[model samples]
Target: MAPSVLIVGAGPAGLILAIILRQNGIAVRIIDKEPTYRPGSRGSGIQPRTLELYDILGVLPAIREVGEFVPPMARYEPGKIEPTSTARLGEWVDPTPDVPYSNALSLSQDEHEEILRTHLQTLSCSVELGSELRKFEHFSDRVVAHIFKTDSDGNEVEETTTFGWLVGTDGAHSVVRKQLGLSFLGETRTEQQIALGDIIVEEGVKLNLWHMWSVPPKLIALRSGGATSKKFMFAYTGRPEHIADKTITRDEFIQDFYAITGRHDVKFGPTSWLSNYRPNLRMVDKMRDGRVLIAGDAAHCHSPTGGQGLNSSVQDAANLGWKLALVQKGLAAPALLDSYGEERLRVIAQMLQLTTDLFHKTFASLHSADKSDDSGWKRGGDLAMLGVNYCGSSIIQEEPDAVAGSAYMEAEGGRVQAGYRAPDAPGLIHSGTPTTLFTIFNTASHTVLLFGGDLEAVGKFPQGAVRVVEVLPQGHSVGALAGSALVAEDREGHAYTGYKLQSDGFTVVMVRPDGVVGAVAHDTEGVERYFQKIFI
Candidate 1:
């Protein structure tokens, strides 16, 4: 019998995992507590890495149809006459030679989820709305889920189903997490209450960029909504007493909006959405418990300082979905599931720490006493959408003489070192189109990047075992690299270079389908050894 997987939550994580699993021929059923799509503009940005993942799912164009791309971010100092502006964050650095997504894209969560829902419909599986999970029991063979749901006629019903695995893609207050007795360890910024609303701005007020006002009493951010609606999200921090009434009047919102924009003639309309949210940074020590596991906000909740929450959640789904599918198919051992938590927890820790630093910096900049000569806070350099790396894990191999460098890396004269993502130079083509390494590589599968050596070495292995791509750099051209459209150049004029592999040494870098570096090697011996250790 085909193994069944039960996923709790119909949000981005749950839906994306369901799609990936279903594509792999796994039986998946997704349940959400909400009866229908929540009518509101919650999250409104999709990072570049996530865009690449969406492209893999063949939904990038659909996202772009209703999405808006926010221009380079700008940062201002309190009471300052000038602000620092950049075209993109440091995270937009060059794409790895094997991965394709190099830039960030902006879209509302509602629109993103809607597109995902539509795509799910085309598949054999669908999300069961109003189907709330009440409890579950896990056995050695399968997991039994107790589900409570309401039918179309407003009748409540209960059902019990058994599945091979149960994934909690629910929100921070995930019932699955709660049921597992997992404790969320971190701090919550209770004083930081933000008032957010989506509304129509007055005529002649063009909303094309993400505008922020670094002033006292509040820190406000304004960005354009997607193409479908002439809507905009206005957010600002306020006092608890100010919103104690739990009622944010339109007049109050417009008053603050005008105060920041210095445009008093602007008129406000009925808001499409309004809510107050408090920032919290928390993570569960363990993401998996027996036959149950957690992903997205259910596993870790961080402050939305750098907009990493949504992107990371989707990534969690990508990382867990495939592993679960492989185990279900009997292609991989059950131990492979343990790597999911081990790998993702490390990534989440980095994200939490980075965002927490941003939170402190943003809040500190509100006070003049906290101001320093350091321009680190300005230019928003601290906000790196792509500077994250997942080395030092069970999957990634460390060189005996590995030298630390930047977040990305490059090989010099046949010697590979740790630092930044591997660069994508020229002479690399996929399906006849010249592309960078990342453009051809993604988190969809475990990628075997073979640098140098003849293709015959890879022929020994089965075709499905690995994705083999050769790197041959002709020359370095800034335009050629930029044209690849994976990453933009920094102010330092330092763009990643594509280097040709030398000799028959053959450097094999294995990247997990979720974009994490699993292992690296220099010859077929190490590659074969790694395969034995991981697959067996």
Candidate 2:
């Protein structure tokens, strides 16, 4: 099939959006201007909410196999390397039935992209490296783009293609975003610049703990690179005077490391990558412009302090993918695409506030009179991103009780609501085998869980666009239902408890393709009403 979607930039956002659209059988062509897959440990933290999304995308297992938990930081006082305190950046929590992946996973951004790329390839789509989106024109019906492709022999060729949609996942200085004329409004924190790099530590450093040192106005930190033994990722707040007029080099990194830690004994090897990172609290005024849209760094940029940059970008793609697929398939009106920006803009606005506030708090605490204050280093709660929802989104239905303004509010006491994350329930018996809700949920279509065993409700939705499941109580026989819907027995009552449903009560939950509860209805009429908004 010819590609229907043209994605600019093969980073996580673009890769994930391609993966999702392809999962729905949407053909996509993803391109990046870079000569090869980029390498770096940029934005290494994967929040719990992202893990849940990856679970549906079938990439979580590989991520978990290679992903390492955030290591404890070995805090060292000046001139004293061996004697100091150690602490984890975030508290580790045991997994629950509703929340299977509770802790943040740490793997370099490059490794993360490789996993996503591999998954995309499995779906029969590959990213076009050295293919740059030079220009694009968006019409009411389609997007026409001109791309520059450099072949192996260094020959440059230009091609024009028409696509149903165009998405810019290109980084901060996005050519697609500039063409759309979207306002990227925010300021750069020049005072909070940090030098980041990946290097080989020859000796005298352990891989278990992230080494840290405080130099009052500057902070230096290093952690082991999970993919390789001798490699490590490090960051240092460089002194303005030292970095004023010189280019960043391996020698400069070595000098900064030695100056900050006073550890002349620690030997260093080759530097793989180095960059001067200045935090920018900026986001586009909107995420879409007709047939052209933007996601990830192309749409927003913020501090790396809370590790929310990449996670937010990935979520942006998740939120937009299914919507675009529906529109492309002609299953929904074009206005369905409007909710993509309406829903995400509100969430991104709050995320910017949270991350920006966290950034200020972390740096303020670090440079305070009490150098031993670790309060700012603590992370959990909202930082885990489990609370992110589209409660007030125009697409959500029958959620009168859901708060309209904030997207960060968690469903109180595990109470399920429209727009909240669809909770996962384990110990479900499907065809005499134990299975979980996460495994049953489909990423390509909406999942309608019929707790009342209303087999007739299955007829209300389009066949391929929705999957209907009948949830029976423990010991209930599935023989009574004669329908196409899959039957799962809640053998351990986890499904009822997690969703706040009584054993005999009938409840219908519509889990969106993104794994968010789209509607909590009392009957088939409400379910039909909800799908009316989603489908034409």
CA lDDT of each candidate?
A: 0.66, 0.86
Report the error of model 1 at residue 417, Å.
6.4
Q: Model 1 over residues 96-173: C-alpha lDDT tens digits?
A: 533345555677778889999898788777788899998999888889999998988999999988998999998999
Off by over 4 Å in 1: 1-3, 64-66, 72-102, 213-215, 226-229, 240-247, 255-262, 369-385, 403-445, 452-465, 469-500, 503-505
Expressed as tens digits, the lDDT of each residue in 277-325 for candidate 2 is 8889999888888889999999999878788889999999999999999
The per-candidate count of clashes, in order, stands at 24, 0
Query: Which candidate tops lDDT?
Result: 2
